[model samples]
Target: MPTELPMFPLGTVLFPGEALPLQVFEPRYLTMVDHCLAQPDRLRFGVVLIARGHEVGGGDDRTGVGTIARITSCRPGGGARLLIGSVGEQRIRVDEWLPDDPYPRAVVTEWPDEPSDVSDAAAGELTDRLAEFADLFARFSVRQGRPALPVPVWADLPGTDGDRGFALARSLPIGAIDRLRVLSAPGPGDRVLVLCDALADVVAALRFRLADPGGAE
Candidate 1:
């Protein structure tokens, strides 16, 4: 069933279980936040990555896949502004884009979660890949003179394969496009596939950096 959902087209992608901090300065988004807060049933909005143009004046095109963002906190900021923190709850696919009545809206369909897609083998592989990727990133940071970059420990990650997958992917040094690919993936297994491919290239670069004698080892 197609449902109309309030959308916030942004320059970034929101992954399920991710926390995003937003600054509400624009009148449209300010009003949007007010409306969301007024609704007791759900203080949520949809966030999609802008395909073209900017997030400021609203001419930007956006991708169909997005995540449901639940408002966690809303604090008063400098005059007419709000500092908001939201956590992604679920994924949704835009069936159609409706007119921007003050704010953008979409006809959306619920994106189903298929945990079974994340097989035992895939989960194990994802965990291993995350560890290697994290290690490489930490080393790469050290080479760049940022010695304080924390190395990710596998045990510290979320217990579920799905949560761990999003957490690791979010921490990657890859570009926004690759991150969207992971966010829009149909299931956890598919997200891992895309992430693994990107991770391979990143890890290779990190290895090359560490190999150079001039670089910090």
Candidate 2:
């Protein structure tokens, strides 16, 4: 049987193992939170990146695949709003969309991650590339004079396996749709290639930024 869950579509995609802190104020979402809380497990809901439109309104399109968000902490936010701390759990593929009179609901099937056939050497190289990407991004941000945002250390990620593909995707700066594409990838090897392609462009751009500050921005 497909698991039915409350869907909260936003402009951002949640990669498994990512922690998201969100504010819930919309009436429908408040009700959705209530539903999640009533469940036996800690309030768990589905989180999808909106395909189109904004997060503040109805009529937004959403991606079919998303991660389950397990609420870790919930507290009052000023008035009727709520401050929620959640971590991405499992990936799910939306099989059906239910009515959203109050809040979004969906029937989804589990889309568990599949490992890759990457050799030990390839895996180590991939991990090194991720770390290098982080260092480059941090340096680029500093050069741009933006507040320093440290890149997530790839080793700290759970599991020392192929799924680090998604881990790397979440760590780097990539487009929303691209991130979704990574999630939909067949296996870790594919996802790693996708991320590597994106990283190439980003690294080149950062180098350009270094050479001609006015040329790249």
Candidate 3:
């Protein structure tokens, strides 16, 4: 069954098990936060990627798939703005988008990953590939005179294989579209495939840059 949820369309994608921290300054979102805080037990909202347009002020195209963000903490920010700390808990598919009556609302259904067996070896390979990708990207960043991006500590990853995969996907410094592809994957096995492809592409690009600083064929 589909249930109504407060929708927050952002320029980025949020994966399950990822932390989401937002600064709420807009009147509409502030109201949404207040409403959620009022119902402590139901302090949750949906976060979807804005296919087009800006995050502030309205009028944006939103994707149908998103993650449920459960509010863990809320406090005041500079000048009446709100600081919210939340974590993505589950995936959801939007069945219908409601009007922005002060805020965006959607009728969505839980979209859990389909069960699939992921062998220990397969999981280890994914992790190794992710590590390689991260290392190459970091080197590429430094070569471009930018600060090296931080890598996630493998020891701190989630317990289950599926959860760890989602965490790895979330940590990837990919673009919104690519991140959305991972978020929209059907199951853990499929998601791993998508991630591996993305990692390969990135690694290749980084290798190219590292080889010939002048990005040429």
Candidate 4:
């Protein structure tokens, strides 16, 4: 069934199973939050990247597609600060947008699922690479004393047999358009390839940062 949902367009696109933190202070968004809390289903909203348009108001080309996100925790700010932790659930295709309230509202339908087909060899390679990336991320977090971020709870995330490999590929440090392409990929294998491409850039960026004087180890 098609449903009306409140949309939160961001500078970045979030993937399912990824965590996104936001500072919500706008009055419309505050109302949206209140609505979600009061709803019986505790329905979540979509987090989408604002593509080729204005961010604060309406944009010229905003993708009707987005990932569903759940509000896990929220910290109220004295005046306009609202700290929120959200996790992406699934993909949705927006049918039509209604208006731009404090936040945007839209009528949407659930996007069709795109499962992946990964070969054993490719899967294995993905596993090793993800493990390396995960380790580096963990180390960097520890070295920098940054708050620990949550990884997926599912098994086989960075391994040969699990969907985790695909997840990690989509979630790594990548640009919004690349992330959107992964999200829009027709199948899992293609998505994984997109992830691999992003992984390459991630490696290059990490190396550059690490080599820099201001970059952490």
Candidate 5:
């Protein structure tokens, strides 16, 4: 069954188990936050990627798939704005988009990943690919006179394979579209595969940049 959820369309994608920190200055979103805080048990909202517009002022095209963000903390920010701390809890598929009375609203259904076995080999490959991508990205950053990016420690990742896969996807230095592809994957196995493919693309791009220091491709 589809349920109505307050929607927040951003320029970036949020995957499950990821932290979402937002500065709410707009009147519409502030109202939405107030409403959520009023309902202690239902302090959550849906976050979708803004496919064709800005995050503020309205008139944005949003994607149908999104993640549920659970509010963990809220406080005041500079000059009438709000500081919200939330975490992505689950995936949701928008069934229908309703009028934005004060804020965007959508009728959505829970979209859980399908059950699938993730073999040891597949998991190993994902780990290897992530490491390779990180190394190459660090080198690329250094070559550009920038500091090397911090890499996530494998041992510190989630214990479960599924959770770990989502974490890996979140750590990738890829664009929103590629991240969305990982978020939309059917299951853990498929998500890992998509992430690996994205990592490969990033690695290839980094290598080309490193080789051709000043030449434009």
Candidate 6:
């Protein structure tokens, strides 16, 4: 069934079952926050990827395929300082959207969740590589006086590993199109594979950065 949802077009993409922390300072998004909190379902907002143009006046052109997200936690950072944690649910296709309001509203078509097609061997290898990568990341963060990156529970939950991979794949400081490509992948194997490639890229980038803080020719 189609639903009319309030839209939060972000500069990034979100993956299902993954948590995203956001600071809501924009007036329109603050309105979105109020609406979501007041709604009965609590499933009031959809997180859309910013595709083109700026967030201020971009309209619907800024958003891509989105996932229904719920406001899991909300805290007041001060006067109008809103901190929100959202967990991605399912994908949705935007049918119609209207901009120029306090917040954008989109008539969306829900995309149901599809089961994973990843083989055990593939999942295992992916998990192993991801674990090594995550451990390295956490160690680096702690060594740099930053909070430690959480150890991803990659074994007990197969689906979660895929979700984590996809989430990190989108979040890395890579090309925008590559992030979109991961989001648009066809199926579970394809998505996981894409994530693996992204992880590899991140590892390579980290090595390069550590080797040379400046882009030395």
Best by TM-score: 5
Whole-model Cα lDDT of every candidate shown, in order:
0.81, 0.80, 0.85, 0.72, 0.87, 0.70
Which of 1 and 3 is ahead in TM-score? 3
**73, model 1: CA deviation in Å?**
1.2
User: Who is ahead in lDDT, 3 or 5?
Assistant: 5
Span of 10 residues, lowest total lDDT, candidate 6 = 208-217
Q: List the residue pairs that clash in candidate 6.
A: none
lDDT tens digits, residues 13-85, model 5?
9999999999999999999998899978779999999999899999999998999999999988989899999
* Tens-digit lDDT track of model 3 for 69-143: 999998889897999999999899999999999799999999988886666665666678778987887777776
| lDDT top scorer | 5
Q: Write the per-residue lDDT of candidate 1 for residues 70-95, one digit (tens) a residue.
A: 99999999899999999988888999
1 versus 4: better TM-score goes to:
1
| Per-residue lDDT of model 2, residues 1-217, tens digit only | 5988889999998988889999999999999988888866738889998988999978999889998989998899999999999999888999999999689999988787676665666556666666677677677667777765666554566664445667767767788878888888767667766666677777777667667857426
Q: Which ten residues in a row have the lowest lDDT in candidate 3?
A: 153-162
How do all the candidates rank in terms of lDDT, highest first?
Answer: 5, 3, 1, 2, 4, 6
Model 2 lDDT, full chain set: 0.80
TM-scores, each model vs. reference? 0.85, 0.85, 0.86, 0.73, 0.90, 0.72
Q: List the residue pairs that clash in candidate 3.
A: none
Clash count for each candidate, listed in order shown:
0, 0, 0, 3, 0, 0
Model 4 deviation from the true structure expressed as Cα RMSD, one decimal place: 4.4
**Cα miss at 148, model 3 (Å)?**
5.9
Off by over 4 Å in 3: 119-128, 141-158, 214-217
- Per-residue lDDT tens digits for candidate 4, residues 1-217, read 7988888888778877788888887677877888887865865998778888755545546886788999898888678768888898878888888868656888888775566676666655656666666666665666667964654422445553224643664556677878888787766677666666666677667666656667774
In model 4, which runs have C-alpha deviations exceeding 4 angstroms? 124-166, 204-217
